[model samples]
Each structure stands twice: as structure tokens, then as C-alpha cells.
Target: MAGTDKQQDMLAEGPAIILVEPQLGENIGMVARAMANFGLGELRLVSPRDGWPNEKARAAASRADHVIDAAVMFDDTAGAIADLNFVYATTARPRDNFKPVRGPVEAAGELRTRFAAGQKTGILFGRERWGLTNEEVALADEIVTFPVNPAFASLNIAQAVLLMSYEWMKTGDQAVRPVESRPEPAAKQHVESLVAYLDRVLDERGYFRTEAKKPKMIENLRTLVTRPGFTVEELAVLRGVLTSLEKFSPRKPRGSGAPDAG
Candidate 1:
């Protein structure tokens, strides 16, 4: 009973953990255990790969019955997060459209602060086989990505959730607070503005005005620019790039730097 109450408190403090179409019962149960590790317990399963209420999952949950007992099953992702005021989709790859992204630590800190501020947040995790679909990603207000080794960046579902849960656990621990190790997303307005500026720079470069296969190339370029979940710092770097181009581009004729006559 005490454990159950503790789990409930954790949920009250932490954001809802949403697993999108998880593939196995064991993984589902493992996720519960991971949540428990960070004092988190509420679990929302959306279109699970293996049907829920399986003994297999129970076995994986082990002593985390409190987590399993409260696990909610949903037929759709939207249904699972319907009551959530904020949603963040976790992915290893990126979307075609520019989406706000933050490091899990930054995201977790933001969530903890927001939860205390009276807003409900949801963290969405995708399937073990495949991550969230483009359609699913569109539903989120934010995105979270880990700084994993590029050679092997594919993180499994439970592992991914664990990292997120761990981050959220450090709400007040100043020693463990976010440092240079992690970066948060740039605001929507900032990203949009930077993108517009980049388009202008690229235009000046004639990157988009070429005649051969220009249409396809521009489409691809736009997608690439829009995909990364850029943080304000990243956006600043790019903006610097734009400033540099604007200063030098549209190059004057040869000997353009000649001193002006008195």
C-alpha cells in the first residue's frame, strides 16, 4: 500500500510516460521497472505490439507490481495523451519539419518545473522495431534526443525511457543539473526566424535558384534545413553564418575592396 502511494506521488510529480506501440511484453514490463528506478510509475501503452495483461509482462515487471497495476492501455497515441497539456516525442532520427528539441536532461528539468507550475506533460516513446511515425511526431510540442555515439545511436525503447526518467529525477540536485553535456531546444519563434534568414542566405548563394533539377534540389534542401531539432545555441551559430554570408555575398566586381576616392 505504501509503495502504491509512493508511485502515485511520483506520477503526480513526473510527466506521463507514453510508450508508442511497444513490441514486447517483457520490454513493457522492463519500462515499468525503469520508471520505478527514477521514482516514476505511471505507464501509458499505446497500441502495444504484444497484447497487454500478459503474464510475460508481469514476469518482467518483477517487484514493480505497483507500476504494472496502474499501467493504462490505449488503442491510439492521441487517446493516451489527450489530457496532457504538453507532449514531447523522443526519437533517434529527426522529422522532415522543424520541431523543437531539447536534451532529455533539459527536457526533464523543464518538465519538472512545468509540473510544479501546474502543467501536465507527456513523454512519448516509440516502438522497439521502429521509432514514431512522422504523423505521430507532428502531435508533439517538443522533441528529445540523446547524445549517443554516432556509430551506434539506436537506443532501445526501455533504455531510452530510462535515460529520460533519470534526467527528470534530478530536479533539485544542483550538482547533477544540466551542464555543457546537454543542450535544450531553441524556441519556435527563434527557429522559424533563423530558418527564414538561412533561406535568404541560401538564395544569395544561388543555392535555390539553379536551373538544373532546382526544384528537387530545393525541396531536399528545405527538408534538411527543417529536420534538425535546433537549440538556440545552434540557431545562433547558424545566424552567425547568415550574417557572414550577408556581409560578403553578392560579391562586388574584382578589386571590389578598393579604397573609396576622397
Candidate 2:
């Protein structure tokens, strides 16, 4: 779909995304697309290998014209992040330095706290092949690492940017929480109604045939029905099922349908 003027106005206000010596124009474009997906606006390129104004990158970015149009170029990593007050470097391997290491979620939370307090922040991503040098990782205040399979932890440049961006977006968004959208649990009356209906059906079917076990069986049946905490709709469905069985079944003994012995 074509981007609209209104959509362009909804630019994200968060950390910059810095690419240190990224190799491919296609990767740059995909990075732009990922940034756009998560509401990240600022994109800084530190000496991209394929050079600047790459048509391949622009074409690959697809509908994220705003990100491609506003991308800034820098000669080195230091130049790329010089303006930011806080910076994070993303690396899969543990560096020798004692810098604070955080997963993407924790890093995003820190970034959100800082950004909201009027501090500029950004994250540094390394090259496509060898990743950042020790010196580059040292430049950032903290390190961000992905919790991936140790045997194969390599991630593409765009994929890395997408992960960080998604987490950053989620930091301030309560919508991602499962409990936020969950329907309220069914009321006590609804559950009681279901339990009563079940008890009546089982009692008529001689489920509690033994006089001594009748009270215990009823209690167990009520416990089983109430344990699930069924919603109103679920209770209605259960009641409909019980009514159907009662309407269709013969009033004879439970084994009346069995074959007669010779």
C-alpha cells in the first residue's frame, strides 16, 4: 500500500540505529524496513561498504521511504554515535571487557527510561561477517546480546536491528502483555449454575448409585466443573451438551444398547 501523509507524521521517537561498516545495500534497505516496522526513525550508516545513495538499498526498503530518505551517513562508528548521550553495542559473543551486558528486553527498558528523561540514545550494530572489533564494542556504555542457541548464534544485520527495535517498541507498550486483553474470569453464579446442572444430570443417570458414595460423588462432580473456572459462554455450551444427551438417550439401563448373550 502507498504510504500516506498522515502515516509519515507518526514517526517514532526513540534511539538511533547505527550500522558500522555494513556490507550490502540490500541489507541496508532491509534494515530500514525493520526500523520502520518497529517505529524507529533515525538510521545512521558508518561507512557502508557499497557506498551511499544506493538504488538497491532504496528499492529493497520498499514502502519505508521515510527511513531511506532521512538516513545519515558517517565516516566511522565514533562519528555515528557521537551525538547520543547513551549507546549500546550488540554482539553475540561475550567480550573480554567488564561492560554491563543486557538482553534486548533489558536494554530496551534502559533506553526507554533514558529517552523519556530527555537523554538521546542509540544502539550500534556491527558488520555482516566478523562483527564489531573489540575497540568498537568498548566505545558503547553497555552491551546487548541475543539469547540464541549457542551453537549457532549468528544473525543477519537486518534481523538484529529488527529484534532490538521490536523490544524497544514493546518497552513502552502495555498491549503486548497477555493479561491486558484477556477476558474477565466467569462470575461465581455462572460456575454454580453449570455445577448444579451437571449434578442434576448425573443424579438422574444413576452416576451415584451407591447411597454411601452419593454425597462424595456430587462433591467431586462439582469440584471438577468448578476447577476450570469456565466462562459464561463455556458454561452455556456445556449446558447445551448435557441437554442434548438427555433428550436423545433412552431412559432404560446404561447397558441396554449392548448385544444380548445366548
Candidate 3:
């Protein structure tokens, strides 16, 4: 049910499925099957080998006849996709000048985010045997790729589309900014407290009295502690560091020549 919201928003932009020059009726039917599984409709066929909307294709599609019924035939790939605002070219390997390669999930996430931000997008999948030509792929706004074991990463076109759809459904509209992930604020606070406790111990041991700029030194120390945005684990680490420093400090308690355990 986690992906239900996504599943329902399935067609936020009424995205179209553009199959550029499918080779077989079975593949078209399979494509239809894949689209139906993910609640995607609007099949745009750019020519075919066995003639589309046929019984063979229908048989392959099975319950996904809605896609077959409404399948729009096109004379060319551009004709099929001319109405789309954004296009994603699905490819397994890089070609035609280095472009940013997005994994299925990542591409879906981005497309969904863009759709939520009001962009009509479509995915451009090529023929199975030869994949998309450089000319066809060049028409796309971005390139989407899948991660697989390099030795055996050949994914069927329908499968590739389904995976991308699954990821897009999961993405929703959260435009998460990529940052140098920091620990939680609460954890950061705990680290700050640990550092404070350390300062108090060092001060009580007269390490600061010997130094004229004690306040400036502690202020600088505070700056370093506050910026980490620490997590619980990070705070624990700060505590460990303080404990180690305390054990190794030159000063000691009145009876043991060790820092006070206070």
C-alpha cells in the first residue's frame, strides 16, 4: 500500500508510451502487458513488423487490451512522440557523446518530480534487437539506463519500462536536495553537549587558566561541534572521543593525578 498513492497518481500527466519501430507483434503485446501492469495507457506505435492491433499482439497483451484497443499508429518515431513535453531514452550503455546516465529508479524519480512540477513526459523505448538509433535517441531530453551485472545485463524492453515505471511511482513529488548528508539535529546537539562537558573538565583542570584566549578557544571549539548536524551514532562517537581525551589528559584528580570523573 506504500506505493498506492503513486499507483493512483499513475497518470498525473497522461503520459504516453512510445514504442519506436517494434519488431514483433509479441513484443508489442508484451509492451502492452507491461504498460497495463503499471496502469500506463496510450500506446503510440511507430510502425511494426507483423501489423499491430492484431490477434497475435492482443493474445500477447492478454488483459491489457485497452492498450491494444487504443493503440495509436504512427508513421515515424517523431510523429508518435511530438506531443510529449519531456522524453526519456532508455539505453543500457552509453553512446553519442557522454550524457548523464540515470538508473531506472532515478530517472523515474526525476520524471515524476518533473511531472508533479507540471511537465508532460514520456519514455522512449527502442526496438529490441538494435536498440534505439542515435538519431532516435538524440530526440530525447534525457537518457535512462538500468544497473545490472555487466556480464549479463540484457533487459527486455518491456521489463526496462516496467522497472522505470515502478521507480517513478515510488518517487512521488519529493524534490529532495542532494547534500553532504549530516547527522540528525538531536544527535548534533548531543555531540555539542559532550564537547561542552569536555570543556568544563579541561577548565576545571586549569588548562584554560594558563591560556589567555580561553573564551575564544572554546568559541572556536563550539563552532566545530555545532556544524555536524550529528546523528545518535555521531553523538556517541563524540562521547567516546571526550572519554578518551579525559583519560589521556595531563591533569588528574586530587588523589590520583587524573582528571576528575565528575
Candidate 4:
């Protein structure tokens, strides 16, 4: 496993690999090792069961200290993914949901496309025992499900992460395309804010109608809003539109009197 090539620069730029509620420090360390093997550096841990700065994880990293050392921990999945522009939830079993699904190869290709466009992306790996919950899966833009044997589909957490990391690396420079300059995609937080604002307005308007259905309504609204991948400027324009609709009044007609000299 000693394949250090100091002469060549390490490939450290790629999608963030997010582990949601990982249970073991050793597993986290193995994940870091896998990430390092494929040049993925950004590691996000959402509520690691064993807590951060675990010595066991460091020991398991096998000299991949950079990935382990730079890892970030978040209180919850939403916070962990708030800064990402796009995300893919890695799950094995079907969740009986409507989210678009892609295999590892196709997912990797899409990752390359988004990365080339200057959009930050990440992939979410669920708990080791069970995969991502439906609510957590809903936060992601799409689903990434591996095409494993039906009889034995479960994959170890590190193995799941490694498959994605490896596919991302395998896609490499060949998958990247020429990208045109454009406004950066709005981060998840921006979308969340917009959704929250809309939800508040809708609640004031009694748009939910029924208390029991409110949660589903909000979830659907979030899914709808997040699917478009709005750019920063687009989001600002949307906010302006919403504000004007809520509060704008007809202004006095521009005065016919000569305007102040420039």
C-alpha cells in the first residue's frame, strides 16, 4: 500500500465526501484513507457517533492525516450540507421516492460536469448499518445507488465511500468539459432561506389549509425549489420578487419637473 509519489502533486480537488452519523472512529479513518487514495480531501462528518478527534480514526487513516486532520464535523445533516451547491445521497435500497437515481459512473460524470462549472458538490453516505433516511435523502439533489448484486447489495461504509471516490478519480480529466463563465450556483443555505421565507408567508396565508399535511407540503416545496439549482443572481431576483409582491406599493409617478442635473 506504499505508493507515495512525492514527485507528483496529489489530486486533492473533488466533491466533498460526507458521512452522516458514522458509528465508528475506525470506519471514519478508513473512509479518510479511501478518500486520500482517490484524491478527495474534503471530509464532512455529520454527528459522528464516536465524536471528532477520535484517535481510532486517526490510526485507521494509515497516514492519510491530511484528510483526517482537515475533516469537519457538523451537528446535523442539514448543516453539513448547507454550503454545498449540489449533493448526491448514496443509498442501496429503494426508498420509494421520486428522486432521480444514478449509478456510480453516471454520478461521477455529473460531478465532473458540475465541478467544471464551479459549483461545489458533495456525496452523502449514510450510517453503516442502515442507509440514508428518506428525509436525509430528500435534502440531496439526486440519488446515487450502486449496481451491486441483488442478492447481496449491502456494502461496507468505507467500501461505499471508496467506490464513489474511485469512480470520481477514474472519471478524471477526460470527463471534464469546457465550462462557460456564469454566476455561481446558490448554496443550499440560500435555497433553505428562500424556502423558509416562503413557508412563513404561506403559513400566514393559511396555504397549508390542514395542519396534518403541512410537513409534506413543506417537503414538497423544498424539493421543488432545490431542483432548479438557481444561481446567486437568480435567487436574489426571486427574493426581490417575493418582497415586492408582499410589500411593494405604487410609487408616486416620476415628477415631470426636470430631474436634478447630473
- Best candidate according to TM-score: 4
In order of lDDT, best first, we have: 4, 2, 1, 3
For model 2, the stretches where C-alpha displacement exceeds 4 angstroms are 1-12, 174-262
Candidate 4 structure quality by residue, lDDT tens digits, 121-160: 9999999998788778878888899899999998999999
lDDT of candidate 1? 0.73
Candidate 1 has a TM-score of 0.65
TM-score of 3: 0.60
lDDT of 2: 0.76
Which regions of candidate 1 deviate over 4 angstroms?
Answer: 1-4, 174-262
Kindly report which residue pairs in candidate 3 clash with one another.
Answer: 252-257, 252-258, 252-259, 253-258
Compared with the true structure, all predictions reach lDDT values of 0.73, 0.76, 0.67, 0.83
Lowest-scoring 10 consecutive residues by lDDT in candidate 1?
Answer: 253-262
- 94-191 per-residue lDDT for model 2 (tens digits): 78566778999989987877666656678999999989987677557678999999898899999999999999889877423333333333444455
> 63, model 4: CA deviation in Å?
1.6
Q: How do the predictions measure up, each by TM-score?
A: 0.65, 0.63, 0.60, 0.85
Badly placed stretches (over 4 Å) of model 3 are 1-14, 173-262
Clash pairs, candidate 2, are: none
